[model samples]
Target: MRRTRRDPIVTTVLTLLVGALLAGGWWALRSDPAAPAPAPAQAPPAAQREVTAQHSRQADRPVPRTFDRSAHSTTDPSSTWVIVNKSHPITPSQFRPELSIVRGYQVADPAAGPLTRLLDASDRQGLGFKIASAFRSYGYQDSVHKQLVAAQGEAAADRISARPGHSEHQTGLAVDIVTPADGRCDFEPCFAGTPGGRWLAGNAWRFGFVIRYTPENEERTGYSAEPWHLRYVGPALARELRETGAGSLEEYFGVPGGDYPPVP
Candidate 1:
């Protein structure tokens, strides 16, 4: 007996079904097993950076050159003028004279209303202090500077004279205290020698005043010791400066010592 031939359609259907099953099994077996998980994304860098104004300003600032103490002449006597070489030059006429009083051929102005009140309070406490000089004109400084130069060499004059606009007097916030004879403007050794000077040195901050130049800060101020000179920087700031004993305003403000004019 002869076997019967199967139908072509049925044979094709069976062959396709088997192939599908084999493909599925092969894919399942070949797939990776126990694969590690992917890592997390990294964070972006910070957008902000820290910078200080002082650091930026330092680049533009002018470094002070070595001064020839012997070569420079003092203020000219024949000419009545004041000129500040540091920062810029300023004339006496530019100063506000309305807020000041004249004493010993120099101007004296209270720093502000609050400071004046404080000064009054100090006076009531038996401090007995008076402002000797304030708000000097460039012309006045020039004439005096020249006289000092004539009397002494440039170095000595620089120790005592402030070039015009650079003076704290131009800011109307500084004063010179009167000594016992007015002739003796001795601002060294110790302010404690006089009652007024002593009281100021102790309590000037209460009235927004500070010794402009101190012995320790001679290099920063570009001048020798001066205990008579007082600068008004407000009670809060003055108190801070006094406590820190940082020497001069330049140092307190982070300015290079050589940039400021000599203490006059």
Candidate 2:
């Protein structure tokens, strides 16, 4: 035993090689299966929430299909939606609607009941509203326009009276309302401040009527404010006008209405 001793260097080298081998084997065992590739990430629920919010906004908005503007003819004299203005006149210069009497006032057959109801409602409030003028013929309008032009010049007459075919009264849907009890402001601008006028302004739409010419829309209508002049457009259209806040049929329909265009 004393004669067979190993070299210290050899022993040291052998220990180092064995340690290295052990380290390599441990590292291989620990890293071997590649740690089961990480589970794929999932998306947050935000997309579904955004879609629900978008649907709610769409539900709250108003749909344009609720009312159809083309429901009635705007050019036909008999149509409730007919637009008579300086630019668009009644098709035939002498066109007249079939007339009937509403409380002794002549109006279109379709307008009689609504007009009567309007006046009766006024009477209930101790206000007497009379139909001063309704359903004027082409000749009558011509005469009225002529008189106004002669008395006050063409510029002034254009504000108060419409030309023959351009008159809404020719359609039988227009009425000049007045208070018979006092006749103080009949057909005058002062009437707009009267009780009857105020009531009509606020409530005429209930009976399918609208003040055809208004101070707010005089320029577009080619006339001055006429609080007493009402045009029956049927309840549906009247409601639409009120809801949309349209000043005149011309503005509502995107049509020209400042003044009569030159005759071709």
Candidate 3:
């Protein structure tokens, strides 16, 4: 409808009133920050709804994948994941795994690659890790234990040495690492604080090895902390242990690991 004789003053007043209303609405919106805008009458598309649901499900944060504990044998002596401790012994006491030499140290072939990578990584980081001990035959271990016992007595020997059948070295999955730069700390607890030791403690999980015995876990491991002692359980279990914060294989696996059985 055209108003040919419209009043200019009245039109200006109406324009001002409309402008005032808009300004008031803008201020209201600005001032009420907590108030959400009105929702659309129509629902969002399925894909959009799904996206919103997914985002909202941070309450639905994707569940972390569960690790299969039985992916490898913990009881079989040859199994890469075998748990060897004072409470658990190699069944035959002379069990030997397929061997490979890494830097002149014999280790289970399954461990060779990861151990190699670990060593190489250490070298790259200037850690200069050396293998002080590796696979030991039952007889050798028995002799070693006897020597320690003779030197330091049974109680002291047991703290630092493993009985023949109960030794992880016999499993071919354990390696004693030392740093030539810090040779004085070889097989000593102070090694854990060394540059290489700190690096290995924090990074070895990436290569499937773990600082097997620790002071915090000594009661569970049945030995004093030997940061030099590394047991290969493969990268999978290593990552799981690192993630779950399990300090000892015995604690994680719930296997008995304290003190040797009383002699019959």
Candidate 4:
């Protein structure tokens, strides 16, 4: 009987020792920092391809185009981007643009095709608009300025006529649009509300033109509102001005334009 009891006790002690050895082995595996982690299951090829396509679609979305504001010279007389005002005069003081006749009116050669199309487009809409004046020579502007000064004093002339060298008409890219059906408000503020004027204001940019002066920009342009005056700056620049709400070239280009510097 003692032998049987001793055998049972030895067997139980062996079993406890084996259990401790197994526990130690498990602890060693868990505590080892250099042990390799089990690799995760890979996704199926189809699912991987679907994820890649989704990412490609997102990457393919087009970004909005940014406008480059410095693509042209704002001071070059022949550049479409020229910004002429009271304070900024054409270089050489007598520079004239190459002229081409469009609808019996003279305009810069580059402006002819666009002006012709603009007029034709207006006509298709039944708008009675016509180009009244364009490409006035420096001498002609001088004569006009003197006549204005003679009739209305220097102050009034200054308000209506751009000083001889400073006139945009001399650039050959500026035009005065008028309606023959009603001559009374041809150059008056009331023209802004006319059918043709309203059409030009809304769509001129598409054809490379801008209403150079408005009541909102009179102070900046150093002139009274001239809804009738349209300056050709090419479609790209004109579209930019229209979209940016830039009131005048002076403001858009960040150039000086309030008035002529006091003469010595």
TM-score of each candidate structure, all chains considered together = 0.54, 0.73, 0.75, 0.75
lDDT of 4 at 117: 93
Candidate 4 residue-wise lDDT at 106: 86
lDDT of 4: 0.84
TM-score of 3: 0.75
Candidate 1, residues 75-181, lDDT tens digits: the string is: 22111111122433344435544454333333333355645675577668766556666667667777888889889987787666876556657655567665444
Clashes per prediction? Answer: 11, 0, 1, 0
Off by over 4 Å in 2: 1-65, 262-264
**Whole-model lDDT per candidate:** 0.57, 0.85, 0.85, 0.84
| Deviation (Å) of 125 in candidate 1 | 3.4
Tell me the deviation in Å of residue 210 in model 3. Answer: 0.8
In model 3, the Cα lDDT at residue 226 comes to 88
Candidate 3: regions farther than 4 A off: 1-61
Better candidate by lDDT, 1 or 3: 3
Q: What is the lDDT of residue 39 in candidate 4?
A: 73
TM-score of candidate 2 on Cα atoms, chains taken together: 0.73
Residue range 152-200, candidate 3, lDDT tens digits? 9998998778888989999889999998875988889999999988998
What lDDT tens digits, residue by residue, belong to model 4 across residues 28-106? 8799977777676875453244345445545765654355556667888887788888888888788988999998988
Clashing residue pairs in candidate 3 (N, C-alpha, C atoms within 3 angstroms): 57-60
